[model samples]
Every structure is written in structure tokens, then in C-alpha cells.
Target: MTRLAGMMAKSAVAPLDRLKILMQSNCPHYSRFNLWSCYRAVLNKEGFLSFYKGNGAAMIRVFPYAAIQYTAYELFRPLMRALMGPHSHIGNFTAGAAAGTVAVTSTYPLDIVRTRLAFQVKGEHVYYGIMNALQKMFHENGWRAYYKGYAATVAGILPYSGSSFYFFDLSKRIMLKYFPKQTTTVNEEKGGRLELSIWAKLICGCLSGVIAQTAAYPVDVIRRRMQLIGMHPAYDHYNTAMWRVGVIVYHEEGMSAFYRGLSLNYVRAIPMVGISFTAFEFFKQLLRIEEHAPTS
Candidate 1:
């Protein structure tokens, strides 16, 4: 159910997702493009379907990613709460970071494939399909290539996932505090839990996404840049170290390099997180899962 919800939410923002990747990539050809210009370029060059270039890989990758993320969160949350107590935000943050790390480690290769596919021009296809992309990456650099930037990704996701879940849980509590009537009580066999209204869930998700994405975006940019090493012509000589990539981006493009696609990310993230949390919560309700806890 979490996987389905993730796929649906991702599909809703597929075009923007592609755009965000393109904007974030270290490819020199796309350096001048913004969201609208990139959209126009894709449309004119590859037609409408171009917007979904890597969505197949995205869906395939996201299923496991989301499944592991949510599952790990659930498993870790109770442990964290037991360790840090129920009201501590550190529990939520730690759980989220652990969940993100586990999920990313399990599914990092597919992300490289997705980015490679998305970065391709319409007729200038570097990879014909997912399998071909995998084959090419393997043949080019062996298994290590798949795990390129992996440490950076884990590092980035620590803050991204930690802050996202932390803020979401925090915001939900605030909303429930201010609008107590909007909260619904769920009677579980063990204990009762409060569920926020759909609107509150959406609001919490969006705000959390924005804050988290903004905070961790520079690391994300560095991760993307490192992932493109050996893949993008501009980064052909680049190493996979996070600090090295950060240095290069800063030296060549200045500070703004770290925030390349942040605006597009914000645009995509709000709706993406909103839909993801709302769908997950809705599904939990439908399936009668415990809802009082933070299930982000």
C-alpha cells in the first residue's frame, strides 16, 4: 500500500520530477535552463512523452524505496520512542534518518539508472532502456559504479529524511493542538491514537518537505553531481567524493551551484510530500493500521 501510494504520488509529479533531475544534473548543455525553459526544451526536442522519460525506472525504483522507507520507519519509530520517549522529536528524526539510510542503501543503483535515463536527450539516447542502462553501467565501471556517491547519498538523506519526518510529526502535533476537533481518535487493541484530518496531514507534509528539502538540498546537489561522474561529459574527470564534488561545483559555479534545482525541487516536493503522506495516511485508515503514531 505504501508502495502504491508512492508510485501514484510520484506519477502525479513525473514531469516535474524529470525537470528537477535535468536541472540538478551537472550536464553543461542544460546549465542555462530553468523550469519553464527546460520544460519547453523537452517538449520541443522530445515531444510530450519526453516528460516521462525515466518514469518507468522511477516507479520501479520508488516501490522498494518507499516500501523500505515506510517499513523501516515503522520498525524504528517504536524503538526510538522507547529510547527517547514519545514526545521527543529526536526519536522521529533518528527513525527517519535510519529509515532513509536503509532504503537508499537497498535501492541506490536504480536511482543512478533513473538519473541517467532522465538526463538523456530524446534522440541522443545513451541508454535504450533500464536493462540496457544497467548493462552499460556495469560494463563500464563494474559493480562499484552502481554504488557511486552512495556515502554522499546516505549523508544527504540523513538530513532530508530526518528533518522531513521530524517536521511533519512536529507540524501535525501543532495542528492537532490548535484544531483539536480536526483530530480523530483511533482505538487500537493496545491503545488509542489520534489521526489528523486530511487537510492537516497535507499541510504538515508540504511544510515538512519544503523545510527539509531546503536544508539538505546542497548535499543533494553534491550527491547528484557525484552520481553523474563518468556519466556526464562535464564530470568525466571528477571523483566520487562528496567534498571533492562540492569543491569543484563551488570553484566552477560558485555557491549557487549547490542550489541549482532547489526552486524546482520545492515546487515538486510540496505536492509530492503532500500526496505521499495523505495517501499513506488514507491507506492506513482504510486498512485499519495504527494511525496515532507518526507514519511518515
Candidate 2:
């Protein structure tokens, strides 16, 4: 029957659709484009492939992290605006902060895994899966390990997201101010000039990511060190004090230790932030969300 044949085709395509999503999710094209490039260069000192050490697990983590991050930003932001008034910077900041927190929380476990995987070298003990990583952490250091460096993650993401939302919003305003005609063109075709060019939005997002990342870099370093604490046998004594950990690293490996993987971090940051911001901007526009002019 025609109906039976249609159902068969749908079933055959379902797996392909899932596979496409999985590949798209796992691709490090964004990471490779940004901070990961730096990370890779650093890894080249060790070996060519060192840059991708924990990449398999990291890819898995990215799927959820990206989805949760974008979804939370989109879904929670407007609800925040509705409740707090559209033009309030306070509201925007709070919404952004909450969205960052929620997205990070949803994806923290995977982040922990990704960090663990990235830090892994050949012959290093590696986690098998998410549940295995959780079990291993709990078995070794109690439940606290799952949340290790979580404070730093929160500290970093809060400003990162807040600035991202704030600056991206501002950039569009500036773009509109400079190119009023674009708005008219956009309005004619895509509803309004407020729609913004894809390129403009990308530039705004990339700049925002840089500013936000700069502000939060130290916390990010702390977060990564904290996440890697339990993985290394020598670092077992890493206490909760961020400065203390830095001191110990300095004492052990001198100043260079603290910055061991910084190149990789930068490599991962640039493009990741660029893509993330671009994605956020595009999604926001796709949803027809208007940027409320910030009141100074």
C-alpha cells in the first residue's frame, strides 16, 4: 500500500536524521576555529594528535552543552523580559545570568568529562562514559567532585553570558545607527531593519565573546584546574582554595605550570565564542526577538 511505503521511508530516514544531528553536534569545527587552535598548537609540542586527546568524550559533551546553552538562552531570556520589563538592564543582566547558570548546570557534568578527557594523555586513566565518570569521581572523592570548580564555572559564565547579551544587543544598536538604510531594506523583505545582517550579528557576537572571556579567564583557569584535580595522582591534594592550587602548581612546575594548556584554551575560545555568539544572534533573530535599546 502507499501508506505502508510512506511509513517505511519515514523509518529509514529517522536514523539518518539522528546521525546527522550527532555528527553536527560532535564536529569540532567551531573549537578548531577558535581557542582550540591555540590548544592544538600547544599540543603539537607533545605530539600532533595530542590536541584531540579527549576529543571523543568532548564531542559527546558538546552536543548537550551546545543544545542546553542555546536553548536556555533563547527560552529563558524572553520570559525574564516579560517578567522584569523589556528595557531594564537589570532584567537583561539577570536573565542572562540565570540563563547562563541554567545552561551550565544542565551541561556541567559533560564539561567535567570534557575537561577530564582533554587533559588525558596516552596511558592516563580515562573515564568510560558520563555515568562512569560520575561513579569514578564519587568513588574517589565523594560527591563533591562532580561540582568541583562549579563556583568558578558559575563565576565565569555569569559575566560571559551577561556581557554577551548586553554587548550583542548594543552592537546591533550601533549597526542600526550607522546603517539606517539596512533596516529599511530588511523591513521591506524580512520584516524590519532591526533584523540585522548575519555578518553584523556575527561580528557583535565575536566581540562580545572576547570581552566576556577576558573578564572571566582567571576563573576559567581555576575551573579547569579544579576539574583536572582528581585525574592526576600527584594533584590529589588540590584543596578548594584557588590561590593555593596556583601556588602548588607554581612550586611544582614553576610559573609555566599554571599556563600549561592555555594555548589550547585560547584556541578553543575564539571560534567557540564566535560560533556560539553567531548562533545565539541568528537564533534570536530567527525568533524575531527585538533588541531593546539599553538605557544608560
Query: Which candidate has the highest TM-score of all?
Result: 1
TM-score of 1: 0.91
lDDT of 2 by residue, 138-177 (tens): 8877867778878878988898788777776777677777
lDDT of each: 0.82, 0.59
- Candidate 1 lDDT by residue in tens digits, 93-176: 999999989999999999988888888886678799999999989998999889878878888999999998899888876766
TM-scores across all candidates? 0.91, 0.70
Residue 162, candidate 2: C-alpha displacement in angstroms? 1.6
